[model samples]
Target: MISCVFLATCFVAIVADAHEAHEPVVVVDSDAMRQAVLAWRSTLGPELTRQASFEFAGPVRTDWHFVPKDRLGVNWHDMNLEQRRAAHNLLRIALSSQGYFKALAIMSLDEDLRRLEASRPNAQNVRDPERYWFALFGDPSSDEPWGWRIEGHHLSLNFSSVTGQVVSVTPAFFGTNPAELRDGPRAGLRVLGTEEDLARDLITSCTPAQLKTAMIAETAPGDVIALPGVEINFGEPEGLSAEEMTDAQQALLRNLLDEIIGNFNAELRERALDELEDAGFDKLHFAWAGSVEVGKGHYFRIHGPTLVIEYDNTQNNANHAHLVWHSPDNNFGADYLQRHYAESPHHQSAK
Candidate 1:
């Protein structure tokens, strides 16, 4: 049986706005995100803005998903050239260059899927690179807190800000249906190749005892355990604790984490590292499921007090991959907003 006695502080709280409320604030370097969001909103005009904007306290802010279906907001297909350019600027502000390009690659895969699934009914209508949508919660220029999301097939990025500081960027999800393109123009291309390779390396390097403890199950699940539109609860920590790993293995684990968290800009990445350090990094757990060999279904998780990362490569014969990074204490800037609402003079005066 896996031990539940790892971290003294690793439980999910189901608050009124649990998922978004307690999310930790990883301060962004500048107000670029707010500026970019405002710039993007400017190009939308009144009608599109009405469609894309929502109240910060509304249910829409927490309603996040990464599937291909009708979404509420302005999609790239409906945007003009200027709107598209502004949208890209907003995305660049929210993500690192590598992450920005990776998102673009994921968007491109929609077209690839359209072609590959051409024979399937409704494939053509369902798969389009421009299907990605952008949404804003509250006025970006206002003194109150605000948030935004950009979601489409295989991508969902939720960001929240309070008083010009980016408080949350959780439920950050990225997936690829054809993990490795076989015959497209970008043949053999793997957008999430680093995410896969680093995990495989860490799992394969585990010693006999380490592997025994880390390998939680013989079979990998078809999808990530933490699905969309739900409160994340992984129960207790159930994996090999970092205390069990050697120096080299620990370094490898940190590298894997950096590759994932570093997808954000420099300031956010550094703050994330600080968070890990503040929370007892050695208390983190690494768990693996299924075969570690390439082309075989596999899943792995890195769970800690401040962070949760779940990766699965189990669908389409291990050719589909999903990766997510979430903060337990703060998923949607819950911590920051809670403080802001309690302490802000404007909010207090309104009350």
Candidate 2:
């Protein structure tokens, strides 16, 4: 009997391993990916760029920033199957193309990653070839669902996808130190050229009357007003609505907005565009701050029903750039959360 029991256990272990090995890998459609890549590249225009490639093997081998194993707020083991899948998908997206761009943005910095790793050994270690250390607390196993953070300097993205839905994508940040350079081997490099030029041109093109409404304040804020952890309160819609603009002006605004928000994948970009359309162009508020002169510290913000874009050209004598797009209602697919909760045991049991 003892021999039989031991043999049965071994069989079960082998089967489990086989099942894991055969799990379907997430395969992004190449054509779809190509289109998205092209759209983003077109926005970049001609710029000095480099390519880096990586292949991840599950969470175990994924590059993640390290944090104290005890402080990880997620309990992955407690999440159901669907929850686990969603969490994995979110992490995959975070680490794939978007994550790659973040790394590339800072790759130019001399010893930036090395210094961060040394100063914060626990917080900055890269665990696997594809995974960097950026968490503090429990491991990201299927056993427990826990909050996890993946950050490295200019790139800081946090996610808490539990029970088959993403909780948040806040503190999602992207910044380029050298927005544009006048000298270097890659001289006249402008990483985010379209993002800057389009908006500037739109504002400059506005009639004096339009500028009166678009430029809410003459002063530029020292930093982005909507910092992390703050409740997103969009002030009243305050700009000349698209309906009010001349056809040419309207076209420019649309093109500029497209260039700004097209940084995401196709699906997300479509959703954002739809939201913008539904909100109506008249509802948007465009506010500017600081000097209007190029190469000077300046900032602009666009707020509408489904979009909020903040651009700051303040660092390095207005050469450094920061831009962000946020949707108050749909960030991290808040709509998906309602569906997930409806099926959750916690909600079902309460009902």
Candidate 3:
């Protein structure tokens, strides 16, 4: 048998390797991410820094959308290599390893689109992975509140912090053109494969009576934004609640939720989970619409007191897909800001 000391050393080495394998799983407080953001901005000085910064209450922070449209911020494409790396460093801290890899993989698809330009209609140069923009809402170091976003075609991540702790990471959006690159230089690739499969599994697991209430529509819209105005309720919770779901159905629902919101960094992921748990899973609703088969139009949504996760695969013959997670109550740290404003009535978040 191995010596006790050697066995202990082996166990420690295994733990170290596991830690190395999953780096971002370590809890990083908002102050660390804030310092990274400020240090990165300092390199640009006033002009460019001011250009990239925006007011917390400005339209840019609230005028959210996932479609390819004119956005206001400093585009990554315009930044130097070092500046781009600094921006990516902030993202590295802000997103989990799973999320960050998913993001970079989505960016690679831009190259795939470029290669398939003759046949792909979305070959516009706007899809350049580097074209993503970053804009900070205020000074994160100070006591006041602030927010930030790393956004571009098919990817948008919004993060808001109160007093250096992330309070809201809502409106996280991820999408793709050819959900599966069946044939190409980069064939057999599916970034969001699990997200889709889990929901489908939950839907298929439902009983006929459960599905009757769950299937709200025969044809899902080609896309859904889940923005502020979007109706979270398709119609009086048109599906079974967690309380009524079978044991297996409930487990699938929980796992489906875990897969979706758990894409963020550890700290923010816990915050999202806390919000969901506080809302009570029994209060959550799982609904489905459109055809149930692959390569057919389909959509599903998980809506709760403050959380909404929407997925629509209705474009490109059900190849194009959009997924967004929204927390209406805490969006942009609105609830936190409201509390802060009430306590200090005269204090404004942005000077």
**Winner by TM-score:** 1
TM-score to native of every candidate shown? 0.89, 0.59, 0.88
RMSD of candidate 2 to the true fold?
15.6
lDDT of 1 by residue, 1-351 (tens): 111111101221222244457555344557888889999998888999999988888888888888889899998877887888888878777886567767877887877898999998998879877788899988789777888999988999998888877878898999997999899556887878888888888888888978889999999988887787657788887788888888888888899998888778777778788989899889899999999899999999999988889999988989999999988778888877778777875663310
Backbone clash numbers for all candidates listed:
6, 38, 0
Give each model's whole-structure lDDT.
0.82, 0.50, 0.76
| For model 3, the run of ten residues with the poorest summed lDDT | 1-10
TM-score for candidate 2: 0.59
CA shift at 50, candidate 1, in angstroms?
Answer: 0.8
lDDT of 3 by residue, 1-351 (tens): 222223223443554676788744588775778888887787676777888888887777876766665577787656776776677678778887667667766666766666667565665764555566788887776777788887777888888887668888877889887798889645766778888898888888888888888888888976874654575444455566888898998999988888877778788778777877897979898888898887788999888887878899898889888898877667778888888888887666464
Model 1 ranges with Cα > 4 A deviation: 1-28, 345-351
Query: Which candidate gets the maximum lDDT versus the true structure?
Result: 1
lDDT (tens digit, per residue) of candidate 2 on 256-324: 777655444334345557767877876676667777888888888878877777888887778777766
lDDT of 1: 0.82
What is the descending TM-score order? 1, 3, 2
Output candidate 3 Cα RMSD.
Answer: 7.6
